[model samples]
Target: MKKIILYLMSAMLMVSLAACTPTQPKMETTPPDPQVMASTGGASDKVPDPNAEPMEIISVYSKNDNKTGLNQAMDAVDKLTAEAMVSKLIEYGVLEEGTKVLKYESADGIGTLDLSAVPQSGSGDDKLTIAAIGNTFIENFELDKLKLLVNGKNYSSGSIKQGDNDYLEYVKNYKEIK
Candidate 1:
């Protein structure tokens, strides 16, 4: 009887341990590659899966071009949701390297995007940067409004604000940067 109780206790402990935050990024690729592992630094919940069927990433905004301010382009992602496509944005140099999407959910036309360690935009183009990130989630998640959060709390930087009245709207006029 004692052995049976000990075994049950051990099983329950193992189950409880599995519910904790993972040590590695939740890349569904079974076998992780070195580049993505180092890039996201386990900050992402969903990473691209090479073995999985890639989905079309609607628009990955980039400011790499000197002439065009913010340009939109398409790419392939492992998953078909905005959460999965966020890693692609990091790869494209849109969101900073350390930026992490902690939680994402939408309902009643409002999408809450919780991030971690978001870099503050000090330049005069904070609106453009906000549009790039907001539109990505808005267009992809099909939300009429966005609530950006940092570390599960409200976020604000430069011209951006995270409050009930500070929701962001979608802007679809970004020219492609080629």
Candidate 2:
């Protein structure tokens, strides 16, 4: 009877030990390639599957050469909409390449476009630049109004304000391609 009780306790302990042992997470069983491991400082990086399909990107339209055309694909969509907008303006050949969009937000049907690192422009360039921005936003995002800022300060445009901020208006000289 003593031997039998010892055997039963041994069986229960074995079962409990098995239950306590942790299971390993599922991972690729293949050993890391020597060349790949060496290139990544002895660590394997997540490599994109060669068979995967390319990601689809949305292309925004812009005015170029006095006619509208397909511009570059959008770099951002939601919160960074102003960055994409400024990029489209650059694509339109109006805004300079180094212009930086600091912030972009929309509230109560009003959109704010804050910019920095923008190049100084003459009156002619400013007109063309504003028109390019206005037409693109109006045509693509259905936004006819916007508050533009340069380096956190309001743009000095006395004639362009609608209510409290400078609003984007349509420019008759900019012709859109059919």
Question: TM-score for all predictions?
Answer: 0.60, 0.48
> In terms of TM-score, which candidate is strongest?
1
Estimate the TM-score for candidate 1: 0.60
Q: How high is the lDDT of residue 104 in model 1? A: 84
- lDDT by candidate, in order shown: 0.72, 0.60
Candidate 1 per-residue lDDT, tens place, 107-127, comes to 999998887766677553556
For candidate 2, write residues 30-134 as lDDT tens digits.
Answer: 999776555554335667779876552434444355435333335434433567667756665657787888987776666777778444454344454566566
User: Runs in model 2 with CA error above 4 Å?
Assistant: 1-80, 117-119, 157-164, 176-178
Off by over 4 Å in 1: 1-54, 176-178
Per lDDT, the best of the predicted structures is 1
